[model samples]
Target: MSDTFSPRTLGILGGGQLAQMLALAAIPLGVRVVALEPDPQAGARLCAEHLCVPYTDPAGLARLAKCDAVTLEFENVPLEALDFLEGRVPVRPGRGLLAHSKHRAREKEGLRAAGAGTADFAVIEAESDLAGALAQLGGQGILKTSELGYDGKGQRRVQSDAELRAAWDDLGRVPCVLEGLVPFTREVSLGVARTASGNLAFGPLVENVHRDGILRTSVYTGGDQRAEAQAREIARAVAEAWGLEGLMTLEFFELPGGELLVNEVAPRVHNSGHLTQDGGGVSQFAAQVRAVLGLPLQGWKPPLPTAMVNVVGVDGLDGQALEPDWGAIDALPGTQIHLYHKAHRQGRKLGHVNLTAPDAETLRSRLAELERLIP
Candidate 1:
């Protein structure tokens, strides 16, 4: 691996909060970022040189190609665009992982190929296939679009043949994957960073809670010896199998019998990892930047127990009508807040707060206090 210590330019394909955080992490390392996004008001534009153009725009791709190393903030970036930039500039984690992650079917296949266990699933090509797919998965399953789905979107739960047909129709008869629901006790996610030189760093295994299929909170699980070992092994195997050059997150289901099944893979920095920013010495964004630049990777150890609470836009409350008491939140000890400056809508991720405590009891107390503060 080559050293990139001399003022390097990093290119990011999407300009959302992830890219914004990455840009902030790169500043102290003397690394500059060029973000390609259609929105001129993207959060990343606050820190990086923004190329205000669509992902597929020729001029935008050309400008991104000039960076020393490029990475994507979101998986939905056009594969063709990454293909165009592959040889022109080094795109970390590469397009192979991107292609696998961009679609649900391909992602499941990639996991099975790596010898990882996943929920039994089948493909739904058309409405006609829904009934048979449902039968194959035992009459109850989730029908998800094969591509471009996130945060509970592009998914439908069907318990009967009639419901299956309706869901297929509702999803526009697009290519989809039908996965049997697993009766799991809880959800956990692990983030791993691997460099080109094969150095690896693992973030704390976090227990996740979701509401309406969107991540609501992630608590750092520090002392679960068995679960932590298994989770780390799964993450490491997947990263090594894909030969990942940057960061990726593996979300898993913890069954009642103490088995971990792979749920999904995000081939970039993940939302569940937001706690790393304040809980530990190295944040996920910083680790990603170092990995992409071929810098040495370092392990993360949380200095205190922490929990991250996601602040979602309230239903029936317009962005203009919602006003949070920031002063009250800031007054709380060991709390750090980060608000993504974006137009708010119902169920949208507006920001997150990281609360740290000396132990688990105080952490739970802080979480309860935070719940009362959110509007």
Candidate 2:
């Protein structure tokens, strides 16, 4: 590992709030970021030092010429483009991890290869494969995912064998995975970071609540001795397996019998850990910056009790934006607000609030206050 963490220039593949937050974290390290996105009005566009021409453009390849290390804000980046820049600039997490993250089938295979536990599933390459998958599951199941799917998109729940064909067509008969739904008691996530030198660190398991299949709140469960230990081991194996560098998140399901099963993996800073900004002494964004830059590990502390509420913007929010209301939420001590500047769009993630207290009850109360304040 290099003694110094400084990089002349850092290039980011997507220009969303994640990139914006990453740029915010890199500021103290004196590193400038170059962002690549098609939208000039993207959230991170204003924050990055230099915005590259466009992803997959020849000019974008030219922009990579100026960067020392590159990272992705999202998993949808064209792999061919990253392949062109790999030898020239350091791409944290590397191409293999990125490739695995893009597809659900491959992700499960990677997890199995790493000796990690995951939900029972089968690969679906064509419509015929769907029937074979259903036969294997032997009962009601779900068509796992299409490569680029997010936020409940590109998935269908099949109740009977009859629905399998329709579900397959609904997903455009694309390559996917079919997973046996688990009757899990709760869903949680453990965010982890790995440096180039194999140093690993993990945040505690967070209890996640989802609405419409998108994460709504992530509350700290705090010190589940067994789950925490298993989570750390799982995260470490993932990092070691991919020989991954930088940050990634592992979402897990706590089964009825007290066993933990892997849910999904995000090879980047995740929405579930947004609370780290105020709860943990080290925010996930800050940790990611440090890891990607090869900085030394630091202290890890949890905000004994904390709750993170995601703020989703609905249309016609501009009227409410002018008189932004945080009075009730702000009244709570140790509360922090993070707003992403994005144009009004239905169900778009606007920002989040991290409220902390001595216990989950107090944290819930503060979150209730925040809900009332959201205009």
Off by over 4 Å in 2: 1-7, 299-301, 315-325, 372-375
Over the stretch 1-375, how does candidate 1's per-residue lDDT look in tens digits? Answer: 236577889999999999999999998888999999999889999999999998998999999999989998988888778878989999987988887878889989888888888899998886566657778888899989999899999999999988988888899989999999999999998889998889999888888999899998898847667898898888888888888989998999999998999999998889998888998578888989988988878866476788898888875434364555678888888889998888887788889999888888888887878767775
Best candidate, TM-score-wise? 1
State the displacement of the C-alpha of residue 176, model 1, in Å, after optimal TM-score superposition: 0.6
How many pairs of residues collide in model 1? Answer: 0
TM-score of each: 0.95, 0.92
Residue 283 accuracy (lDDT) in model 1: 88
lDDT of each: 0.87, 0.79
Superposed Cα RMSD, model 1: 2.0
